[model samples]
Target: MFDDATPVIRRRSPKSQRRRDGLIQFAHDFTSQNGEDGILRHIFEAVLPPNENGIRHCVDVGAWDGRHLSNTFSLLVGPKHESITIAHDQHNDGSWIGHHDSRSIWRGVLIEADPGKFRELQSLHEPLGNTCLNVAVSSNAVSESSLASILQKSTVQQTLPLDFDFLCIDVDGADYWLLHDVLTNTSYRPKVICIEFNPTMPNDLVYIPPCNDNLRHGASLAALVELAEMHNYLLVETTIYNAFFLPKHLYEQCFQDLVPDTSIEALHETTMVTSLYQLYDGTLKLWGCKKLLWHRLPIEEERFQMLPPSQRNFPFAPNITSTTTEISDPVVDISAYCQSQVTEPLHSRRECSSQLLEQLKSHGFALVHGTGISAQLCRDALRMTHLFLQEADESVRRSCMSIRDRARRGYSPINTENFASLIGEQGPNDLVRKFRIGSESSTESSLLQPNIWPAPSEHWDEETCDEFRSVVEAYYDAICIAANSIVQCICDGLLQEDEGLAASLDFLSSSNSQQSSNQRNGIPTTGLAHKTSILTLLGYQTGSRHTKKHHKKKRAVHPLVAAHTDVGVITVLLYDSGDCAVLQRQVSNSESDKGKFKDVVLPYPVPDDPIFVVNIADCLSALSHDTLPSTIHRVVPAEGSIPRNCLALFVGFDPDQELKLKEGKTVSYETWRKDRIAESQKVLRNRMSVSKS
Candidate 1:
């Protein structure tokens, strides 16, 4: 819930009524926008009235020439000043002046990084008795160039009050970081603050670009609001480029009766950016400006054509329409299919394989029952994962960070991955914690990294830790068996359709020459052996109470995982029963059905049988020459849904195996994997670093 209270009856005080009715009449701007000059004048009248002979102080970072787009200039030099030319020969000797009223003087400290602009700023402000500093401000607390340190070096330090009346931060890049550092590292709590926000960003998005001085992209309004709330500030107003905030106590004292709606959505008035929509048919549509000012990328085209191409559109199964009817026919009886391989006739075996392949080709995913994994095993795995994630100490989890093991192993805390970036979108990080279990390598020189396990701690005993490892390994092995059988079934079905097509995928079969070579080299030769064939145990916990309250609103859907396609050949997902975790987009040719993402349902023929949902991944689409296409899927919090636990098995190919593609060109699996991983990791590292800083 928001901190600002909505009054039952909207009533304004005499001063509040006067401020509102006269805002437009008195709206005179030296540099401020959106009538901020008038608003600040009214605010100061209530907080530190000019008639009361009260001295006021204000600080402005990135104050270029102290007038260009400056929010505090009108307060320092009275709003009535029209055009007072700055003299370059004016003495730097600080001369005191009362600009607003003869009885009270406004003291200011204006800091600018550009030398040329700082000189102009000094010429304009030094004669008016304001301190002008030519120094770049950093967020680093210990640095001499930090805002706190620079404030102390200002010429008006002796006269400056501990708690200034107002502070303006307009550094284009890392504005949020600089403001956060000043609030957290210093004792100065300004009554009013104004900071710039990226107007091109959607109001709902909370994005902060990497903390690099060279990058000028500012933080989103929502990001600033979240930070303000943490510092006990309430967002009161926003212009096209800047947002204004006041401390909660001050807002209640000064403007509670004036500002009717203090909610972020109500306060933000800028709507310059377009919404990016991913249609159900895989088309990307931009409804407004295509240029991303933050990234400096111009999208000349209005619409991106459907991905995976129309030629690759698989015929939908008779029962698998674009409806949430809970069709049960997509669940392939894998145990029966495997039993037919040895006991039934060859035709029967072929029929089952064909059914399994049809489900994958039609829906881009299929739920398989009887994968040699038991329901109890899945429950135990989930139980252990929950225990480990909930009981482990913070230090224990940090010690097992995934990046310590080539980003493939160990415990990954919540929000560690940003799936949206994988698809060139910007949003919050995925809210899933994971612990990965990798295949055991036979040789010491193998490229496979060893999985990291948590040691016994006060949270859990040594016995519990050992039991956790055993249960997780068992679940991983079981899923690997199911994944291998699924891959072979697809291969068999492909052979029936086109032998040449299936022959191209011979390396994926366990009995192929590639497996024999891997065995001779003491490498993992399983049907889906690769460094990325990982079994990841995932846990999604309910977020903060405030977040839960927000999501509970009607028709509000919060994404647990942003829309993305898997990176490997195929992925096998097993989730706890009764949890609606995954939703698959309906890729169809019908325009009416576009933009619909239906919940994936696992049909259980028997009560105790284990069902595993399997989906085609990017690598398989490439290796199959687009005969099969990957699907875009995401996880959202289901209504009345509790915290969920799930397992994902990403089956990939051997690192050294060369995969031939549509063209004559061939690329090793390692090279392809690294390219994709690098792109996502670059974004992830930048996001993680910004969050930490």
Candidate 2:
């Protein structure tokens, strides 16, 4: 994922704020039509509204720290105008705003109503309008204790024709309700309203759970539209949850005024955009997706040029882009599904060992061969001259892996007599040949070049290479420890029935061996050890494009290898990085063994190859699921170098270890795979029981 947090470019500076050309253009576009709001939301998706009109009369409810009021006044009034902005919230005093004015003629009122938050919204900003309201706007009248309402019967001249010009609402949970009440009750309403219609929207996704969680409760867009119309006000456009609205009169005139003011060609009208927003029928809200107002809408260059950095949301964040919800059912909790799989009769998740389950979770395991195997281990035993010679010898080894027959390279077996005849020449079920990850080979020609890894470094002394390998060996050994721990856990209760040999074999041996003398004691007659001994080499086969899906990285094989949920657990044996690990399923004879186990050879990027840069870079650049805080290592394959000498070791597991994770602790949709597997098993068993009944 892209981790870079820096903006592509810094925002425009302060001297540019004086330009009204851009603001006029944006204002025109924003109010162009009923849907012009969409155009405005798009441009201001990451920007603040222009405050050039001054804060002469403003109202902000739930304006913690007075940040909104502070920003509006700073950009527009800037102490030059008789602006009176009120910051009213149930939260904090004005300290969080981080700005103060002394010997200045800035006028405003600060009101804190919630008794619990009286001390916080408790700042004194101006010498006028020291009144604070005790009542909270609710479905019904309600008051908090800390705020003692002191109502003096003021005449109509003093309070009735109250001039509340611009209004901003930020109270959560009750925003729509409160805004509805204020618009309906007040005789003289504000000209512009900034209400948090969808809080935790398009912004603040990290702090709040995905907005879809809200849909589950029904406090959604349908509610917003309902509240809007009751007050003769229409819900304007929105950027995230900050919904801007205006009375029918103002809404019409505002856009009507801005339409003819357009001078900049880049500034676009919002009519078409609003139509698109309404077309989804609440699907966007249900999925917790946000409409990006920036790409479609435009702001006057000067207005966008003046805002501070904090006001803009960085749209380029890695996970900030569009997300597709893969959850199949909204009502089904993940944990319950997983638990069902575990407890289901016959098809219980416990049917597969936990080790197998884990292998399924990681897609596949890293096939590690015999331990203590690394390049350095071989170098320490050899003389320095021989070390250099061995490296050179590996360079010439590429030609040894070419396939003369096209069918073999494709993993497509040739027919009857030809398959038999070729089996004798090959001597094994399948051969491990060096193949490139991005190898371009056709049936017309032979590919003889070797794709060895870590092209030999002529600059390093053999002893140095040995030392590096020794360290790598230690790391590899640690991974082996982790693998063995998993295998041992799986094999723990497994070796109980008929020596606990895979429960599949017990029926075969006892009865058949019991009647024959070849049954030594309780052991089976077919030579229990020989019958159970199966070798499967899992290497990359010659595969066309059944590529990995939903993967951030494009792995050579199918997307499921890296991104798809695994169907079953598997035991991996490594022949080599480029070497093929062939699995023989049911071979009747030596020659059949080669044919029984299909070829699956994984290709690797080698040093000195052109693809080496692209593939190795991708692997190193990719990130891991868990943030281990442990070391991550990568070696860049250089050009004009010897092929890399690499070996990988893999552990064992059952192929069908499927279990869903419970919802409680699981983070995201990753818990879905286990969820789906669990659901299927549970449903399968329930169906089976009903049939029996």
Q: Which ten residues in a row have the lowest lDDT in candidate 2?
A: 609-618
lDDT of 1 at 435: 79
lDDT of 2 by residue, 449-538 (tens): 212222235555455555533443343333333333233322322332124243322322232222334432232223211121121111
Worst 10 residues of 1 by lDDT: 87-96
Runs of candidate 1 exceeding 4 Å displacement: 1-329, 336-340, 391-396, 403-406, 442-447, 510-525, 529-532, 544-558, 578-582, 586-594, 603-606, 677-693
lDDT of 2: 0.30
Q: How far is candidate 2 from the true structure (C-alpha RMSD, Å)?
A: 27.8
Cα lDDT tens digits, model 1, 1-693, are: 544544242324222211233223333343565556655665676444453437878998998987765677767875344574322212111221223544456889988999999999998888888888888887566778888777666555676676778888888877987888778777778878988888878777899777666676789999999999998999877666877888898778766766756776666544578666655534465655667666678764322433212111223423331333254346777774444345757776687778888887775788776566665577677667656664457676666675646346788888777777775556777887777778666545234677788788776678987998888877776677667778877777777876766546877664321333443233234556344478887776556321444445644455888887788888988765324245455563146655567777653221256677888888887777766767777877654333456778888777777877767677888887777768776876787788889
Task: For model 1, state the Cα shift of residue 243 in Å.
Answer: 59
Count of backbone collisions in candidate 2: 53
lDDT of 2 at 128: 39
